[model samples]
Target: MKKLFTPFMLGSYRLTHRVVMPPLTRMRAGTDGVASPLAATYYSQRATEGGLIIAEASQISQQGQGYPHTPGIYTQNQIAGWKIVTEAVKSQGAIFFLQLWHVGRISHSSFQKDGALPVAPSAIQPAGNAFTSTGQRVSFETPRALELNEIQQIVDDYRRAAENAKQAGFHGIEIHAANGYLLQQFLEDKTNHRNDRYGGSIENRARLLFEVLDAVLEVWPNDRVGVRLSPFNDVGDISDSDPLELYTHVIKVLSARGIGYLHLIEPQVRSGLVEDMNHEAPPSVATLFRPHFSGPLIVSGGFDADTTEQALAAGTADLVAFGRAFIANPDLPKRLELGAPLNVPDKSTIYGGAERGYTDYPRIDEIGVNTSE
Candidate 1:
């Protein structure tokens, strides 16, 4: 049996354990998409926690951004800023990967360039709104359909971003093809209603995603590159006529690319409702996707200690990523090892807040070094 705590050699990185901190979007960077000193402090504090650290989804271009303050990788200042984060994580002896992101239709005009409506594969608008810097919620604007020329530009943006990530002293990358983003929008039949080569059948629908991956890999080795996918997630009103066929083809194409890993955000919702009425034995994506994807798998979404151990024990996943747990407990691996009580995350400062909730989480030192004699 492969223990979750056992050491593993993934690509060129030697991880101390199998527990990976999945990419989590805190939206805490400053408005310029510059990495904050608080972010450096936050990751540095959690450095001793085992395995790899996949950094949050970073915008590849200004047009790729949907949120007010998420970090970007295109400009010089952004790369220099992210260097601080990579240096901090490396100092703690953990490998970090930059997650490249492009939020397609999940944006308001206020978040777009010159208040222009965001662009997507189709002219569809998502069912949600975005929070601006002023903390005001605005409905998502209808996205402009992408032209072939514009599509080429977007692909170039990802390539440039990948090269920038390498220059920023980061190890590897995970393309943001999950969570109803640009690549995901391109993959979904409903969101991508183009008649061009970029849409239609499964092969055409997946062209955009594969192209972006190829671009990123041009700057990064397959051993150092990973792609994140959420096949059946209905977020942003995304769906496909044949999810299994589309995903299997996508995975098969990716498998031969010699990519390092594939991280899948498991299906927790189906068509705006909790899956299978939120029943005892809900549908698991591992059953649907595990057979087709023939590479290292990292599964995320609502996994507990026993559940993660069971998945690894049964070979359901190569690694299990915990999102909220890593936020509240910087020493989450140590807590899980000792079965210690987890610090409940404070929802107040979860997004765009000061360092109170970001880097102020208590570690085992504060709890164990009690001098209450």
Candidate 2:
């Protein structure tokens, strides 16, 4: 636990602690996908000098959006909106990275342009429900297979979004290649059934990710960029027949590219394990891939102060990302250091809400408890 507070050099910046705030999507953006000023306050409240905060996933383009009010980086208004957020976080001496995202098949027609089918590596319908723009939960529709030309367009959009992120004053950028999004759809065998250059073998399946990385690199240096991958997440009904082989290749390539770090989500930490778990936790993907990756690794999934210290001490993870914990405790690092009582998060107001649950959580100093009670 003591080591978690020690400063370490990550790329060119020295992070004050290893506790990171991972991207947690709070759908409070406007209908036009512009970030609200509340987004600024939300991030600033949790800001720590020399810590890292990966902002919520922002769609690369209108076609890439899967939910309503999820911010986008493709427009001027969105960029201006993000400028406010980045400025607010930076003023507090925290570094913020924008997660570039595209929700490939985990979407419905209601969010699509002109009722066009959502695009993916194949025309398969994932087994899940998507929150439509109208706030209705509808079954995911079978996404249309992305044409080769369309794929190039999406890549271009990512490239442009990277530039926009830079203009918006972000310290770095994170490529969102996990969670069954567009990049993951192209990486996994079950979702990616295309026989084109972007499918088939592991190399081909991972082609889109590397291509997107290449585009992203045109604007930002390799060391100023990071990539997040979830090899064990099945949230979007995403599965890879050969996750090890696929991720190993992807990690090696990204390492060679000199990216700042690799963010991996551990399986034990997903949202629904308690109710559905039949046995002990599975092997951590971080431990499995640690030797394969030469860069910094940030692992996320239910982690306490003890587990986080253990992972850092064992050299399995460079940092620990806290999502749910950070939701209820804006001063998470401080609270962890003091071993103070934390505010339990309210699940109901996690998404698409106001300050009721977003920024209303009381900090330790503000918790007015009667010590004599």
Candidate 3:
């Protein structure tokens, strides 16, 4: 508990605490892929002085978008829309970073321009549904395999988006290489089946990721860039035949590059005893990769206040990212410090909604009680 409250230097910035607000996709943007005006209020409410808030994932291009009402950083209007949100968060003294995203095969043709199929490293169709631009869930479409030239174009798009993020006044940028997106699609053997320079071997498969990072570095320095990876989590039906070997090499390369931080998504721990687990739970991602990376490590998934403190104290994780808790409790750091009860998030209104479950969550003092008996 004491360690959670202490200040620590994350890259060049000194954060007041270890509690971070990870990027959560709340589909509240406009039809033009502009951020909602309410985003300012929503983010500012959760911000604390010297805290870190990675803004929601914004697509680098129209082809990069996978869902409706999710913001983009490609257009000028989108960049201006995000500027408002960043200004609001900065006003509260929070360091803000925008998560640059590209959903790749996790998208439908409807989300693409002129009904073009979604692009990926390979044309394999994921097993699941995809949200259409109109909010209808349809079967996942088999994405088109990107040509070698197209791969370079997408990398350039990431570089342009990084420049847009800089124009939007973000303190830094986090590449959304996790969640089985385009970057993860290239990294995982199950998704990437190409035999060209961008696939086959692990080094070839990881080529696009490093290229994108290198392109992004041209705009922002390595110390201001962060990369998110989910080595074990299979959010987008993503998997690798050899995750340990692949991520070990990836982390070592990133550590050598001296990036801001490595944000890792821990595997979801199911309820029950260790033996009663549905599958063999691998060791904690933070513990296994902690020694490999030298920079700050932020771990996200299924962490409560106690577990967060324990991770920090044990030195496995430098920072713990809270997604749902920050959604329901605007003043999460303050509430944790006081040991106060947290507001439960409404499940139904988690996405594509107004301010009901978005900005309506009350702070501790705003939660009135009938004490005048």
Per-model TM-score, in order, reads 0.93, 0.96, 0.96
Q: Which residue pairs show collisions in model 2?
A: 269-302
Which parts of model 1 are misplaced by more than 4 Å?
Answer: 269-282, 369-373
lDDT of 2 by residue, 1-373 (tens): 3888988788988999988999988889999999988999999999999999999999998889988788999999999999999999999999899999999887678878898889999999988687688888887888899988888899899999999999999988999998778899899998999998998999899888999999999999888899999886665777877777888898888888889999998766554211222123357888988888888999998889888888999999998999999999999988887777778989888888888899899987788643332
Candidates 2 and 3 compared: the better one by lDDT is 3
Candidate 3 TM-score, C-alpha based: 0.96
Residue 339 lDDT, candidate 3, scale 0-100: 74
Task: Pick out the ten consecutive residues of candidate 3 with the lowest summed lDDT.
Answer: 270-279
lDDT of 1 at 247: 86
Steric overlap count per candidate: 0, 1, 0
Can you give the lDDT of residue 15 in candidate 1?
74
List, residue by residue over 248-346, the lDDT tens digit for candidate 3: 999999999999999998876431101112144466888899999999999997898788888998899999898888989999998887777889989
The numbered model that scores best in lDDT is 3
In order, the Cα lDDT scores of the candidates are 0.81, 0.87, 0.90
* Candidate 3, residue 18: lDDT: 86
Clashing pairs in 3: none
Report how far residue 192 has shifted in candidate 3, in Å: 0.6
Q: How close to the true structure is residue 257 of candidate 3, measured as C-alpha lDDT?
A: 94
